[model samples]
Target: MMLSARLLLAATALCCFATTFAISMDGFATGHKCRCLTTTSEVIPTRLFRRIEILAPGPHCGNIEILVTLKSNNVVCVSPDEKWIIELIARISRNRQQKKPEVFSADQHVLK
Candidate 1:
């Protein structure tokens, strides 16, 4: 009985944590420019660029990241990394804005 109770508490805590982290995203940005030939410079040998955007309204948020990697002047690779990045960004933003970080335990159920 004690073991089951503990497991239940842990699961609840994990779910809350995941939910908070998941809904925390605010926004993100991405851009690319010409790469310099110098040793200490950033650039792309070919014509490539990247753009990313985050759209959040009230309780709902979404992120779209596009990478244009040019194999040739015309050929490119456009890929989306992961859905977690937006969440991570939002969490960071929230953390920064808040005076202190709040952590909740599953054992202490607080209904939202």
Candidate 2:
């Protein structure tokens, strides 16, 4: 009788562990799914953009994603292959490179 009880307890524990593992994997798979389903080639003016997010290709997504948030708080996915989009990305990169923070030197410090 004791042996039968031990076997049942072990089986229950194994089943619980398997169930937990399967549930965790389901959440993981859904969370890593790609954000963009369809993209547009239309070029939006830079001034209308409130924010721009560029996500590179990875295991989660096979293509580059360019998500632009407009001033109206709407998000649009733009095609990365578009010529104007490429130019816009290049311009943004150049601007970022040019706007490096200045390093402070001890000699430039002033006592207030």
Give the winner by lDDT: 2
Tens-place lDDT per residue, model 1, 32-101, is 2212212211333322333323422232223233333344433232223444444545766798889676
Q: What TM-score fits each model?
A: 0.22, 0.65
Counted clashes in each candidate structure: 2, 0
Q: lDDT for model 2, please.
A: 0.88
| Candidate no. 2 TM-score | 0.65
Report lDDT per candidate: 0.45, 0.88
- lDDT over C-alpha atoms for residue 87 of model 2: 96
Per-residue lDDT, model 1, residue 25, is 32
Model 1 quality (TM-score): 0.22
